[model samples]
Each structure stands twice: as C-alpha cells, then as structure tokens.
Target: MTPPPGWYPDPHAPHLQRWWDGAAWTEHRRTPEAPTVPVPTPPGGGTGRARTVALVAAGAVLVAAIVTGAAVLGSGDDGGAETRTAPTATASIAPESPGPTPEESASEPSADDPSVVEDQLNGVTFPLVDGWVRPQYVAQDDVVMTTDGTYDCPGDGTVCRHGLVVSRTVTANDETSPEALAKADISDAAEDAYDRDAIGQKPYGGMESHELVKQGPVAVAGRAGYYVRWRVHTAKGPGGYVQSLVFPSSVGTESPVLVRFVFDAGADGPPLADMDRITKGIRPVGDAGTGGGVGSSIGPTG
Candidate 1:
C-alpha cells in the first residue's frame, strides 16, 4: 500500500522527513519539502485569521530548527555547551589560516551547495546555503536582506526562487531596549512577513503553516541572544522549502541579521534537523551588548 499525500515517517531513512506524493518515496528526500499545492486566497478577502496563525506557527518551527542546528554543530568541541568567545576576539586571537585558494575552491563544488557553509563577514561567522546570494540593498529598517537564486525541485527541473528577510530595529530610546527589541522584531517580522502580501500569493498550497517557538538563549560572545523560527508552505515547483531567519540588531550585536535556506523541498529528511545543524555552527561577528548604530547596521526596508 502507498502512504498518504502528506508528511510521513520512514523507517528506512533516519533523520529524514518524508512526504508521500501518492507514490513510493522519491529517491530525493534530502531537503525541505515545499507545498505540492498552491496557496488559496481567502475567499472574499476574508480576514486570514487562520492563515496568519498558520504562518506564525511555521515561523516558530523554522526558528527552532536553526537554533537547535546551531547548538548541535557547536557541540563538536565542547560537550554541547556554547563557548563564550566572540567572533572578533577569536579572529584576533589567531589569524585564520588561508582557505583553499580561489583556484582550489573553484575546482571544488561551489560553496553555494545545498550544504550550508560557515561564512565570515566583518569578523562574524554565519551559515549560508550554497547557490543563493544576498539581496543587494541599503541596510535600513525593514530591508534586512534578500537572496535570489534557483535550486533543484525534485522530480522537476530547477525553479526560480527569491526570498526577502526583513527586520525593524529598536534604538535605546525605544520602549523596548536592544534585548527586548531583538526578540520582538524577530517575532514581529515572522508575523508581518506572513501578513498582507507577505508571501505575495506565492504558489504554496494551503497546507502551509507557521508556529512561534523558542530557539535559544545561546551566548553571542559574552552576551545572551535568542532565536525564533518561521516555516511557510511554498510552491513545489522548485521542490524545496525556502525560509528566512530575521534576528534583531541585538542578536548580531545590534546589527539585524537575516539568513535564508533553500534546497530540494522533497528532500527525505526532517528539514529542521538539517537546518539546525547548518545554523547552529554559525558565529556572528560582534557582541549584541555593543548596541550598534543605524548608520552602520542593517534594518528592514527593501
């Protein structure tokens, strides 16, 4: 007998989140699953009360996956405890050994592979899946980061993909301090991103949903930071789940941060586990305690 047409468990594949397409498990269950249907516009533009809740629930799942992944990845050296070392301090303490020469890295598969790689930016280290590139825009409130690219859609050719991870900042004067604002912005963006034109009638089926969940109180250097998750049902054309993480400026030491991941949606494994592994290893540049300035930090806008 065949399994149903939704998510199912696969004894043959451990750590894999399998989806039934009314057929056998496709050989490609290594990535997140995009909705195999299209998003339904609420009839008569009815207040998408359920839709909004679903989107929020989805976000919570995504955030949990990321933070969990980070914790697992960072556990290789320490017994699963996050080290209190700042990326800046670590870099200054020991000059990084030069990585593969451009010629060498080029010879190897591109860093933009489904496998997320740890990247260092401005003394910070974060995970970015291979292939997708950051959106080109000014760093301001609302326009946090954008990434557009293509990825394999299992059982189909590659599909066009674009994701925008936006955010809003809270200055010292704001009622919410950097600490509170960080969580609020992330939680709010997760909510707003799913609201009016949030998904822009993207082709995902109505099965998509969002949930708010705790990610972490992981240490960013000496300061503490939290993580939130967002998961949205997306079009299955490209065959992979696409989601973004928006952290308040305080999370990345007062600079808003957005990270996106897109891979074969039909991938057989649980996406959260894979995403968790990829993101947990990331180490941002500075300490959130710094309370960075707007002129230098990136915010939500474009």
Candidate 2:
C-alpha cells in the first residue's frame, strides 16, 4: 500500500523516518530521536540481536549519505528543503558580540594635539610653545606651524602683514648639497618678494629689497644642514628679519628630504632671540631637549 505525503518509518529500515511523497520516498530522512519518536524493535532473540546491530549500522550509513547529498546539492533550488535543517541549527546559536566604537576604531594620533603632535610626512616632532597656535591654513602633514598671531593683508595685495611662517618639504634627490639648496631657496624667495615683475609675490607686501646678513651650516637630529639670515626692507619700511633653514633628512637615504623653517617677524614684533630658540628646539620626533645660544650676527645652529 502507498503511504501518504508525510514523514513515515522507512519500510526497508524502520529505525529511521523517510519522507514519502504519496507514491515514493523523496530522499529526505532523519533518525527516530530527531523527530521525537522512538522506533520499535523486534523482541530480544538471537536473530533480533543481529537485526538490531544491522539497523544501527544502516542508521550511521543513512546519516553519512544525507551529509554527502547535502554537499553535492550545494545551494541549488532543488536542495532548498534539505538546506533548511542546517540553517535552523545555525540560527539557534547566539550572534557575535558587538564591535568596537567609532572612536576606538579610529585611534590614529592627531597632529592638532600639541602633546602628541608629529609630522608623519617629514618624520619630525616638536612641542607647541606657549602663546602659539596652529593655523587652519597650514596642513598637518606638510608642516606644523604655530604662531603667536597672523597679519591680515589689506585689499587684494598679497603682502602688508607680518608673522612667522614655518613649513617643511620632502624631496627625493641627493644631487645638490644642503647649503646649495638653502641658498637657492632663499634667493628665489627674495626675488619673489622684492622683484615687482616676479611670477609669484612674497606674503608680506613684497619686500622692496633684502640683504643676506649671514648664512652658515647647521644640524638637526645630527644631520648636516644650512641656515640663511636675511635683513629685509619692504614698502612699509624695514620689514624685520627673516631666517630660513634647510634640514636634510636624518633618516639616512640616498635622496635626502628637506625640512624648512621660515621665521618672518616685523620690526617691532618678537625678538630674533625667541625665533632662534624655537628653531634650535626642533628635533626629530623624540630627542632629549638641549639648550643652545644665539650668535650675534647669525641665528643658532640646530
């Protein structure tokens, strides 16, 4: 007789239930315990003992076959009914714990933080002195310049203000010496400020003329470099002193990087001594603080 369309004990092996689609078995099967029903075995006897052993072996083989069939069927449409059992078991398990917070996830050190401020691009670090604040215009990676104040130029002219300008740049070439680079940079900057027809004008009302008061070698993190001191005169009258330093990369490489420190002070602004101290205090990310004295003509060496 044909069975109804539902789960029933396998006719050949009654220990396990198999799905019968009215006319025939459809390959879906489960142990009696799985369906919450106990399979009945024949009364204890020599033949019954053997039959019971055979049923246990057949049940093991049935489980193995089910697993193998599930693997072969994969996620095909025809295997939807077979895949539900595995997912149900998975669903019973608790989900994973929540992850870290947004702040915790983004733990990168900030350059704006004076305590831990660092120039990752140039591989240098320095503490922010009192009364000096980092301006929003200067990017963190390029250079960290903190100033006592800023000069807002009047009208469309690019000059007419006086403040310190500190920055850095990294280059990949060893063809020129540090002193040569410093001289060239200073010359170009002076031309930009003093030359009326120059392509780019300097920031502070374009200096009328500038004289190189003194220039000599300096050092940073034990790496050789050079510094140039300029006595600039602008349209507004004696535009204070300007000091530029070119620091070669301390981390040894064929192509040394350059870190520039530009200090532009008005005739009545901060003393040259203060600028000298700040320049000397610059050290590679982490180094013991050392004091240095400024020279009469030129600034202090790093």
Q: What is candidate 2's lDDT per residue for 28-131, written digit by digit as tens?
A: 44454442122355566447677677677655654443322111123567656332221111221213111221121112344355443454334455445554
lDDT of 1 at 83: 35
TM-score of each: 0.33, 0.50
Model 2 lDDT vs. the true structure?
0.47
Off by over 4 Å in 2: 1-117, 139-141, 154-161, 170-174, 191-204, 252-257, 265-268, 289-302
For all candidates in order, the CA lDDT equals 0.35, 0.47
lDDT of 1 by residue, 1-302 (tens): 22223333333543443333343332223323342222355667656786676666655554333223111123545477543211111222122221332122212333444222222211233334433334343222233223444434222232333443332223334342333444555534443333223334433322245543334333332334444444444334322333344343322234434444433333332234434444444444333233212121211111
- The residue pairs in collision within model 2 are 159-205, 160-205
